[model samples]
Target chain A: MSQKTILNDSHRALGAKMVDFGGWDMPLSYGSQIEEHHAVRRDAGMFDVSHMTVVDLAGARTREFLRHLLANNVDKLKAPGKALYSCMLDETGGVIDDLIVYFLEEAFFRVVVNAATRDKDLAWIRSQAAAFDVAVTERPELAMIAVQGPNARARVATLLSPEVAAKALKIGKFVAFEGDGLFIARTGYTGEDGFEIIVPEGEAVALWQRLVDAGVAPAGLGARDTLRLEAGMNLYGQDMDESVTPWEAALAWTVSLDEGRAFIGREALEQQRAAGVPREMIGLVMDEKGVLRHGQKVLTEAGDGEILSGTFSPTLGKAIAFARVPAGAGSSLRVDIRGREVPVRIARIPFVRDGKPFDAA
Target chain B: MSEIPGDLKFMKSHEWARVEDNGTVTVGISEHAQGLLGDLVYVELPNVGDTAQAGQAAAVVESVKAASDVYSPVSGEIVAVNEALADKPETINEDAYGDGWIFVVKLTNREELEELLDPDAYAEAIENEED
Candidate 1:
């Protein structure tokens, strides 16, 4: 049997097609996956992200703990409610998981991690915190909903109290605010203006219905994948894993190489940089009819490569993919589709942004 | 609930066959198959002159989620292929029974048609899958 979210009954009531995702019973789509993809690009769409694990760290050394825990420096986050995207790395520089850290105060910080990696992430954090004297608490009582699109903020505004709405709507990008019994963050995986609202578990269903009443379509994991892919975001296991380092995952920007701050995996990263990283990730586009898919072999002048994540872009009406290849590979590339060598162009990522074509990979 | 015409025959793999007046069989995947595959992004039809054996994988249908093999329902020579689907694969999702017909086969052995499931049996098979 698979674990289920609190919104399981709600998804079934709305006629969703459910699938087992990473050992969790989750909605694949309510009806049409394509329409759901368009809904997030053209208007507002909400996703049940409650499967993600939420951890709270509180202690005098909590800030110091995060500074040593993440690849990205936490000292850069000076303002309260500010959020940072970072990758937790193993000692060897392999990514354990990528997560979001919210700095609410010096002694209190909130971290949201991937659902599939919850068990290992918790164990890793606990093991690391043993010597830091910080308290690590998991909050399974909260449910998360991400409402994303151009009109997402406005649509969600009408559902909140005026005071909360004002504060939430005014929250800067990459920021979060706790109000009206909810933790509203102006951050989203989709390349749109929206909020990832975390509500009490009991109030989740009501909040979902209210969002639906406000014309926010209930999108499922299918749309969520395409939306994030189009936004040039990497899926954890697909794009990178325990064998992939941040340098090869196109996440070097997320790593903060402070002068004196020694974080885990810094030595490996430094060695990789000095030795010239062997692999690099690139964005691919096939404008023709063929669909680029994961595991498809890529033909590059430097050598052979493989696609990490691939999908059909609804906004661009083209097939897009992310591939890991030799660092010396040129822009010219071809994807092998069922024994057919199809020509593909290397495009800058974020294939579609703000419901428009933004080909900056 | 998709319409499963009484005049057509089906395979357990979710492909339907219609025996035409010219002793040829028009083949297409059932609506249930299309629905499970989601919105198709590409379709690879069998060549017009290709020969196929019953239950053999003959064509390919690709949706955004994954790729699926469309098996031949009966042994025959491919007489016609749906060239339109190469440019617009969503037609299979829109009209799986009508314009979405994948190919027409000139049956080399008519006796094989007798082995296919009728509409009643096909419907029951689908129900059994749900159970």
Candidate 2:
């Protein structure tokens, strides 16, 4: 049997089409997936992301522990409630999971990880925490709802007290503010401006209802996937796994190889960088009217590669994808979708930003 | 609640077939099938005059998640296809039994229609699969 979120029954009440994602029965869509996708791009949409695992790390040396555990440097988060996106890598430089860590204090940092990687992530996290004398506590009593879009923050703001809403809306990007029994983070997986709010389990359903009444469309995992893809966000399992490195996953920016901090995967990353990484991840855009899907063979100048994550972008009205090809592969490429070698152009990722098509460099 | 038209025949695989008065058969997926596929993004139709072997993939429909093969319900020569679906595939999700019809086939063997399950049988099959 699959696990159910606090909002599972609420989702069904709203006519959600549920699917077993990872081990949780989650909503795949409320109704028209395209409409939900458009909602996030244009106005506002809320997703029941309660299946995501939240872990709180507490100890005197929590910051030092994260410095050694994550590929990204945590020293950059000098201010409280600031979040950082990083990859938890193995000793061999392969990525274990990609996560968001919010530093509330030196002794306390909150981390949110993917639901599918819950077991392994917890195991790895706990094992490492024990050595650092840090307490790793899982907050299963919390539920997360990501209200995302240009108007998402404004819609969500109406739910909070006036002072709290003012502070939350004024919070810097990638920051969090807690008030009114909620942990509201000005962070989102979708490219849109929004909040990923964490609330106690008992209040999740009510909060969801308030957001819906505020005109936030009820979206699902389907819209979330497309939105994140357009934002050039990497999904942990599909985009990279234990056998893939951050460098090969188009996440070299996340790795910080400084002088002192010898992180878990630092040596391996340094070695790979010194020897020159053999594979590279690139973004794909198809102008033709066919949806590009995962596992499609991409034929490039240097060699061949498979698509990592591919989907139809509702905002662009075209197909977009991520493919890991040979390091020296040129922009001229063809993706063998089924049997036909369909032509595709390389695009700078974060295909859409702020509700419009982004020509990122 | 997806509708199962009593006059139409259904395949266990979810394709629906309706016989026209002119001795040709119209093919489309059932409402249940379209509901499962979510919103359609693209549709690949077989060419006119193409041979559609019964139970074989004669057309393709793609959603945001994945692409699905629309199996030919009966063996026939492809007489006409709903070309409008190439531009607006969501029609299937809207009126699957009517404007969403995929192709028109001049049936090569009318006996194949008898092999299809009736509406009641198809509904039962859907229930069984849902379990």
Candidate 3:
């Protein structure tokens, strides 16, 4: 049986189409997916993201443990509530999962990881934390809701207490605030201004009801995927995996090479950097009719590659995809759609931003 | 619930057929199929002279989520296709029965249409699927 979130009953009551997503019963859409996508891009939308795993690390050696665990240096997060996006890699420099870490204190750091890789990540963290004496605790009693879009923050603020709203307004981008048994972060996967709020499981239904009554449209995993893709955010399993490195996944910026911090996967990355990287991820956009799909072979002048993540971008009104190609591949490429070799142009990472085409903006 | 046109024939796979006055059969997917597929972004129709076998894949419809096959409800030779769908595929979502007809086929075996489901049987099929 698939696991259910706290909002499962509510989703069913709202007439959502439920599907098994990564072993969890989650809502795929409330109704028309395109309408939900437009709701987030133009107005406000909310998503039930409680399926993601949240782990709390508490101990004197928490920061020390994280310094050696993550590819991104956590020392840069000087502020208490600041958050950093990083990838947990294996010893051979392959990505295990991309996650977000919030530094609440020297001894109390919180990390949120992908739902599909939760058990593996927990086991890895526990085994690695043996030497550092960090206590790893999985907080399953918390429910997360991500309200996103241009007016998301404002609409959500209307439901919070005045004092909490004031504090939330002051929370900088990539930062979070906690009060009244709620943690509100001014961050989201969609390339829009919003808040991702985590609350006690008991309070989840009431909070979701209030948000729905406040005119926040309920979007689902369908819109969430399109929004994140349009934002140039990579899906964990599709874009990168245990066999793929951050350099090939177009996530080299997330890796921090401090002079003295010997993180896991550092040696392999260093060796790969000395030797030239072979494959690179690039964006492909097709203005024509057909949609670009995953597993489609990409033929480049240098070599043959395959599409990692492909979809029809709702915001851009075109097909967009991320393909792994030879490092020396030219800007022009062709995708074998069924049997036809269709020409595609290489574009920048983000196809759309702020409800407009990124290239046009 | 999606509308089921009583005057037309339907296959369990969700393709609908209407026998035209010219003895050619007009084909399109049902409203339930379009709703399940979401907003279609592309439609690939069969060639004008291709032979379509009953219960075989004849066309392709793609939405943002994934691609789905549109099966032939009866054996026929493709006579004409709605070429407008190549540019404006959303017509299927708007009107799955009227302006969204996929193609017209000259029936090679008229007896195959009798083997397909009637409106009541198709409705029952959709109802049983829900359970």
Candidate 4:
């Protein structure tokens, strides 16, 4: 048996095809997944991302705890409602999970982590928080809805209170505001202007219906995957796991090494940086027709590599993927699809931004 | 439920076979199969002169979600392939029974056709599988 979200019945009522994702009975799509993918790129689309775990940490040393907890420095979050994307690292510099940390108050901070890593993440956070005297609490009574696309923010604005609506829409990226019994954040996995609203579990159904009434097309996990892949966003388990490091996972920028903070995995990262990272992640695109799938062998001048997360981009009408390879791998690359050696080009990712194509990895 | 043409036969793997007047079998995935594999982006068809073995994967169909193999319904030499699907794979989702026919195979074993499920039996199989 799998866990279900507050909107499970609502999804079935709307004719969704359900699949087990991360032990949650999540909707894969309502109808045509390609059309759902287009809904996010061309107009507004809503995703029931309630499977994501919400955790609250409150204490006098909460801020101190996070600074030592995450690879990205929490000192950058000066103002309230500011959020930062960071990777939680293990003792040996391997990535445990990637999450968002929001500073809502001086002593109260919120973190959202992947559903599949919830148990281990909670255990790790708790074990680390014990020494800092921080109270770590999991908030299971909340649900998340990601409304994405060009018209997303404006479309969602019509449903909020006049006072909260103004500020929520005006908030900068990576910023969140709590209002009207909802937490609205100007951040999304899709490369679109949108809001990831965290609503009360009890009101989630009504909010979903309201968003539908506002013409926000109800998309599902299928569209979410394609949109994020096109946007050059990394999926947690596929792109990077506990055995992988941030430097090799195309997440070096998220690491802040300038500070004197002796965060976990700091020494291992420093040594790896000095020794030259062994592997690197790159984006690949196939000019010909064929889907590049995970675990596909990639041929490069330097050595062989493997695809991490690969998907067909509805926006580009082409196949795109992320491959992990030797750091010295050159521009020339080929992927083995069955028995055929198909050539692929390395594009600078963010293949699509602002709902348009840009030549990229 | 998808249309189960009484004139065609089906395999448990969701492929359908229609015996043509030319003594060849036209093979394609069922409408139910196409519906499950939404928005196909690519299809790898068997060669025109290739030999297809019954129950063996002869072609590949890929949607955004994943890739699936289209098994040959009966052993035969491939007579023709749907070359159009390489450029436009969505044809399978659009017309899995007509223009989406994957390949045509000249029967090498007429006895194998008898092993395939008829329209009524195929429909019942789908219902049981769905259940």
Candidate 5:
């Protein structure tokens, strides 16, 4: 049976095209995927991300448990309500999942992980927490909604309770706060200012309706994929998996190698860091006509690589992709599209940022 | 859903073949097909004068999600191809039954038209699919 989110009925009521995405019945789009993509870029839009799993770790040793479990150090989250992006890894230094952990207090930390990797992630977290005695509780009863764009926060603020709205407005980027029963976070997958609000499942439909009435466009997974891709955000399964490492996936910045912290996969990563990473993730733009797609062969001057995620950037008006190539590959490259070699230009990540395309040289 | 004009015959695979007054059959992907595909990002139409076999892959239609093969409904020689698709593939999504017609072909066997589905039958076929 396909899983249904708390907002499944709300999406259907909005005339969304529902599809089976990673076992969950999620909306692909309300109408036009391209229009939804543009809405998140130019105006405010909302997505029902309740399908993702939210796990709350609560115990006196919560901080200690996380410090040893996550690849990124949780020490940076000294301030309450601060959020940190980190990757959970296996013993071999491969990414299990990338997630956001919000530190509410010394005893409580809330982590949100990908839906498809929920089972494996939960098992890994539980197995690690067994030694630290941290209680890991999966919050499936909470529904998540991400409202994004330049006007996203303001629109969401208007729909939420005054107390919650006030606190959310003041929350810094990558921070989260709890007001009443709501967990409002100033974080999002789209490269836009927004809030990822987690509320009781029973209250989600009403909240979603309120946001829609507040002029937040109802976007779907289709737009979410395009927006995140253009933003240079990595999709867990596509960009990195058990066989791929954070260092090779252009996410080395997230990993902490502080001398004292002995986190899972730290040893392998340290060895790799000393030896040098064999592959590096790079952003590519198809200079010629043709949509760069995932699994398409990317032929670089140094060696060949495969596109991890590629799409026609509605904002850029052309095709762009994230490719895993040999380290030290130059700016110029080519990709095989339907047997034709299409010229590509290696550019800085985030083809678009802050509602505009990055200046290309 | 727009009415499939009676003058035009359709293939079960969701392609329409219009027999023009000059005895040529102009073929295009149906509106239903385009609606199902969502959006058309790229189209590869066969070259003019290329011989197309019935039920063969005559063209390629790609959307953001996946690529699909456009099959020939009738064996014919391509008389003309729609060059407009090269620059604006979205035209197929905008006007699948009219301006978005793929190619014009000179039919090899006019009797092959009998094998195609009528508008009502085609509609029924699609409805059955949803069930």
Candidate 6:
């Protein structure tokens, strides 16, 4: 049997089409996916992100444990409620999972990982924490909802207590605030200004309903996928997996090899950096009419590559994708779709950013 | 949900074909097929005069989640392809039985039409598949 989120009933009640997404029974869409995509781009939308795993690390050595575990440096988060995006890799430098780690206090920190990598991530974190004495506790009792868009923060603030609302409003990007059993973070997967609220699982449905009543449109996985792709965010298994390394997957910026940090896979990354990485991930936009899709063969003068993630951008009214190609691949390439070679331009990572088209295109 | 008009013949793959008095069959993916596909973003249709065999891929429908192949229900030569889908593929989601019609095929063998399911039998076939 597939695992269902706490909002499964609410999704069905709203006429959402449910699908099995990486073992979690989740809503794929409520109605028109394009409309849902536009809602987040133009107005406000909410997503039930309860399926993602939240693990709290608590102990005197929590910070030190994370420093040795993550590819990105946790030392950058000096202040409480600050979050860092990092990838945890294995000894071979293959990405185990990409996650957001929130630094709360010296003894407590929160890590949100992908839903499909929950079990393996917990196991890996626990095993690595053996020497640090940190305790890893999965918070399955907490439910997460992401309210994103231009007006997302304002709409959610209307439902919060005055003090909490003030704190949320004042919170900067990539920051979080906790109050009254609610953890509100100014973070989101979509390239939109919003908050990802984590509340008690029992109170989640009611909060979701309140958001719905506040004119926050309920979106599903379909819109979420398109939004994330437009933002150039990587999907766990599709963009990179156990077989792929962070440096080759266009995540070299997330890796910290500055010094004094001996994290897992550091040596391997250093070695790979010394020896030039084989494949580099790039963004591709079809100049003509065609939808870029995963597994499509990318033809470059240097060598051939394949698309990692692709979709039609409702915001841009065009198709875009991230493709892994030869390191020397030029800025222009062709994609073979159903035996037709279509010209594609090798643009920068994000086709759109900050509610506008990325300047690279 | 709207009724499946009796005059239309159906394919097991969820394509509805309405045989015009002129012997050409208008083809469109069924409402059930479109509903299952969620929202279509891109559609690749066969060109006019292309030969399509039964069970062969005749068109491509891409949704936000994944791409699916629309199979030819009956063998024939493509008479017309919906050019409107090039700009508005979501028409399949809006009117799978009407404006979203994919193409028209001039039947090469009218006798092969007997292999297709009628509207009522098509509904039953779909229900059984769901079960």
What DockQ, on C-alphas, does every prediction get? 0.83, 0.87, 0.86, 0.91, 0.52, 0.68
Instruction: Please list the residue runs of candidate 5 whose C-alpha ends up more than 4 Å from where it truly belongs after superposition.
Output: A328-332, A359-361
- Candidate 4 on A170-265: residue-level lDDT in tens? 899999989998999999998888999999999999999999999999998999999998888889999998888999999998999965898888
List, residue by residue over B1-131, the lDDT tens digit for candidate 2: 66577789999998999999999999999899988999998999999999999999999988887799999889989999999998899898899999999998999999999999999999999999999
For residues A1-361, could you state the per-residue lDDT of candidate 2 as single tens digits? 9999999999999999999999999999999999999999999999999999999999999999999999999999999999999999999999999999999988999999999999999999999999899999999999999999999989988989999999988999999978998999999999999999999999999999999899999999999999999999999889999888999999999988878998998899899989999998889999988988889999988989989999999989899999999999988899997799999999988899878889732
Per-residue lDDT tens digits of candidate 4, residues B22-77?
A: 89999999999988887799998989999999999999999999999999999999
lDDT of 2 at A293: 87
- The TM-score measured for candidate 2 stands at 0.98
- Summarize candidate 6's per-residue lDDT along A1-361 as a digit string, tens digits: 9999999999999999998998999998899888898899889999999999999999999999999999999999999999999999999999999999999999999999999999899999999998999999999999999999999999999998899888889989999989868999999999999999999999999999999999999999989999998888999999999888998898988998867889999989889889989898888888676689999999998899999998888777778999999889986799999899999887776778877789434
For candidate 5 chain A, which ten residues in a row score worst on lDDT? Answer: A352-361
As for DockQ, the candidate ahead, 4 or 5, is 4
What lDDT tens digits, residue by residue, belong to model 5 across residues A59-166? 999999999999999999999999999999999999999999999999999999999999999999999998998999999999999999999999988876888788
Q: Which runs in model 3 stand beyond 4 Å of their true positions?
A: none
Kept native contacts, fraction for each prediction: 0.79, 0.89, 0.89, 0.95, 0.21, 0.58
Clashing pairs in 3: none
Error of 4 at A31 (Å): 0.9
lDDT of 4: 0.93
The C-alpha stretches of model 4 lying farther than 4 A from their native spots are: none
lDDT: worst 10-residue window of model 4 chain A: A352-361
Best by DockQ: 4
* lDDT of every model, 2 decimals: 0.91, 0.93, 0.92, 0.93, 0.89, 0.91
* Model 4 complex DockQ against the native: 0.91
Relative to the true structure, candidate 2 has a C-alpha RMSD (angstroms) of 1.3
